[model samples]
Target: MDRGERFDRLRLARTERVGPVAFDQLVKRFGSAGAALEALPHLARRGGADGFSIPPEHTINAELEAGEALGARLLVLGDDGFPPQLAALDPPPPVLWTLGDPGLLSKNACAVVGARIASSAGLRFARGLAAELGQAGLTVTSGMARGIDGAAHEGALPTGTVAVLAGGIDDVYPPEHDNLWGRIREGGCIVSEQAPGVRAKAHDFPRRNRIISGLSRAVVVVEAELRSGSLITARLAAEQGREVLAVPGSPLEPRAKGTNDLIRQGAALCEGAEDVLRALAAPRTLREPDGRWDGAVPDDEVDAVRDRVLALLSPTAIPRDELARGVGAPAAVVFAALVELALAGEAELLPGGMVCRS
Candidate 1:
């Protein structure tokens, strides 16, 4: 893509109601970043708006400057060396702001995530597993939060690691990890989907967790509560057809329940790094088509479908299947509409296609 085209694509990405799915559909349908950029406002307006607003060119330029100031460049999803696993997600991040050695992402990766207030044992286990996994030539990936995530990065630092953050690459969420962030930028890498200057928010964490799992071959959940963010990453990994590994914890510990339940559901019980590597080495093909349409809904139909979907959804969580059935729309249309709603900040897409008004 040329410079103007690249900027146009970035503009599209930063536009209101334009997300990965819509972006991909636009690109695939239009056949170039240039075309997609030209088509974005038209699509948005067709979906029912007199006008559409994108991030100002000055803002995007400022973000680029900030990334450059930090010695980080923006890595678009389809760029050479972008993690294939991450790129394969239905709605992969459009661009990543990365610091340190981008080549670290080329190495095989295993994500290690858990509670921020993980148990001492869980921390130790994560550290040891990361150390061994690094020794085995695997790159560790995690959200660089406290406890398990911090330990995992520290353990893997000698070899390399990837820290996917909830904020900009230059913005460290947990203030305590400022020094740790510097270390990773020097010895490993830090990346983010949000633009520079974006502060970490609660909603950004799960989006960040998706990248943590999406970039890896497997996700290891060490100690996570039933509702922990780490378990969210584990679920995303499973849905992505990546191996799900759970390190057993004491049943009495509330944090362990998520992992234990995952094990009961057939996630591999991880005893050690060897178990993780073995699972990664196992022969498997998760690239099957699964019969899902890889196309986007026509622009003219986008808003009508979105409104129908909105009518069927409620504050109470409802299964997406039932919502689609109630709306009498194809599942793919519902999925695309949900993606649009999510981008527009009108709805939230939960795991398993469930959505609720934001």
Candidate 2:
């Protein structure tokens, strides 16, 4: 939590090819980010990456300085200020930059997400639902997007709301939400996994959505198309063991397809705050991760297992256990090879212990 270790963690997270899963693995393997930094290059070489790079100390210093200049706080993984809900995730985010009251994240919260081009009725419903939930002492979390997402925050502003962004904490998307972004930064909270001054790409939204669900007790979907990003948030929420609720819409409405399907597949029906409340009262069902690859793999087994894991890997994601079965290696040694391959950029390390070719 001190300055030096914090700097090391930021640098490690910013390092190329190190996603959340690999980040957790490397830290657990070496015991700390500072020690992990020392071993990253050697590990990458074992995975067939010849020239891996770590961000320079000066670069991390500049990033920290930029965040400080904006009056933002950096909450790296393992920091006491990092929300316990997020830390409890299968592979928690390695870094989060916050621009307002970070305390709100630790409080009970629920996510209200939906389509950007939502119907007027849907937007109104989302706003009212958010206000009711906020009055019930739950912080409303959303992406600060237009339509349903924007409306939810407006209704919750007086109570409490947290906006998770795909870009930097200061990078306002939709260009028009400049005012909304400022209000959230001052009155509520603004959060992101990206560094300062970074603009968002299309791929970044999924990662941003992951944080929204991770920080929430449950995710409530409003109007969303069959393939909308809100559906993605609902899926991530379920995968993370958080309850999922959807506000049903008229069957004739195109936006209702996703939520209707979710309900069909067993998502709770959200008529109002009461429905969400009921789901919250139930005990959570997050499966404790078992058969973790915590210990080290001997150098002798590295090349063989790494090659086998690579051969079995394709674009199709497979659970680590299944990968282990295919490679015929102990789960520990197989995962160790995966960590290295992840760092080398040959394999992708996904949440829920799923991996595939990068």
Candidate 3:
């Protein structure tokens, strides 16, 4: 798009309650982010958000300047050189800030992730697996946390690696990774959806995991506990239609539970590079058609569905399709009302067709 439109996209992304799904709805409905920005206030007002506010233009300008100052590039959704794998996400992240060779973002990639507090064997396995994957010409992707993630990047560094961070492209947590971070900035790539200098919050890790898995053709869990971020990434990769692979670990080890459970649930067993290659070669389930209407949506249709949609929703997330069925409305109209509700800070639209109370 044009310069003005690019600025508005960043602004809308930074706006409160305008997440990936809402961003998609607004841009698709209004035709462009510039138009979306122009209509945002009225839309929120109709949804009962009288105090809705847009992030200031100067704030967006400052963020752009910060990115430029760091020599980092901003890859907006739909921009040339934006990774097609990432862009294909149902509602892709609005922007990615990158440091180092941004070329890695679009490379043939597989994720290697496990526990941050990992066993030496797990770390060694992760490093070797990453190295083999790299030598086979696939770039390895990881979250750049301690243990397995750091080992994965280390092993793959000479070939290619991409670090998807929870913090800003510049914010390196677990401070000891400063050396590794520098190596990545020089020879690999560092990327995040957060702005420059933004420290990672607890909530950001799950969001960051989606990008790690989304950028890859498949995800491999080396070792993990019953509850860990690695499994979250695995689930997201599976949901996104990427191959899910897990290393079989000794049942005696506590960290093996998650990967073992993944295997039990039918994730392919990943023993070596060949298994990964074979898994990638396997056919995947076909994605469903992205249903949409042939013509403009009516304001009255949106109004008709709003209250029923509200009554059906609670803090627990429900599928958007269920909402449509519950309200006896067309999916398009229910989605429209949902978007308006999201704008009003009344709901949250999440990945994999989920919607929940704000």
- Over 4 Å off, model 1: 287-358
Tens-digit lDDT string for candidate 3 (1-358): 7888888888989998898888877888888888889888888987889778888888888999999999999999868989988888877899999999999889889999999999999899999999999999999999999989999999999998999999999999779999999999999999999999899999999999999999999999999999999999999998899999999989899999999999999999999989999988877752442656212489998888899998899999998888889999888888888888889989889988899988
Error of 2 at 321 (Å): 1.6
- lDDT winner, 2 or 3: 2
Q: TM-scores across all candidates?
A: 0.87, 0.98, 0.97
Per-residue lDDT for 1-358 in model 1, tens only? 4577677777777877665656665666567767766665655444444666767789879878888887887777667867777777766777888899988877789999898998889999999999999999999999999999999999999989999999888788689999999999999989998888789988888888888988899999998899888888988888778999998878888989999999999999999999998998887655432224345576456566878877777788877778878888777667666655655566665644456876
Considering TM-score, where higher is better, how would the candidates rank from best to worst?
A: 2, 3, 1
Model 2 lDDT tens row, 1-358: 7888888999999999988988888888788899999999999998889889999989999999999999999999999999999998878999999998999999999999999999999989999999999999999999999999999999899998999999999899889999999898888999999999999999999999999999999999998999899999999999889999998988999999999999999999999999999999999866555645666778788777888899999999999889999988888889889888888889998887799998
Better of 1 and 3 by lDDT: 3
What lDDT does the true structure give each of the candidates? 0.80, 0.92, 0.90
Worst 10 residues of 2 by lDDT: 285-294
The true-structure Cα RMSD of candidate 1 reads 3.0
Can you tell me which runs of candidate 3 are displaced by over 4 Å?
285-289, 293-296
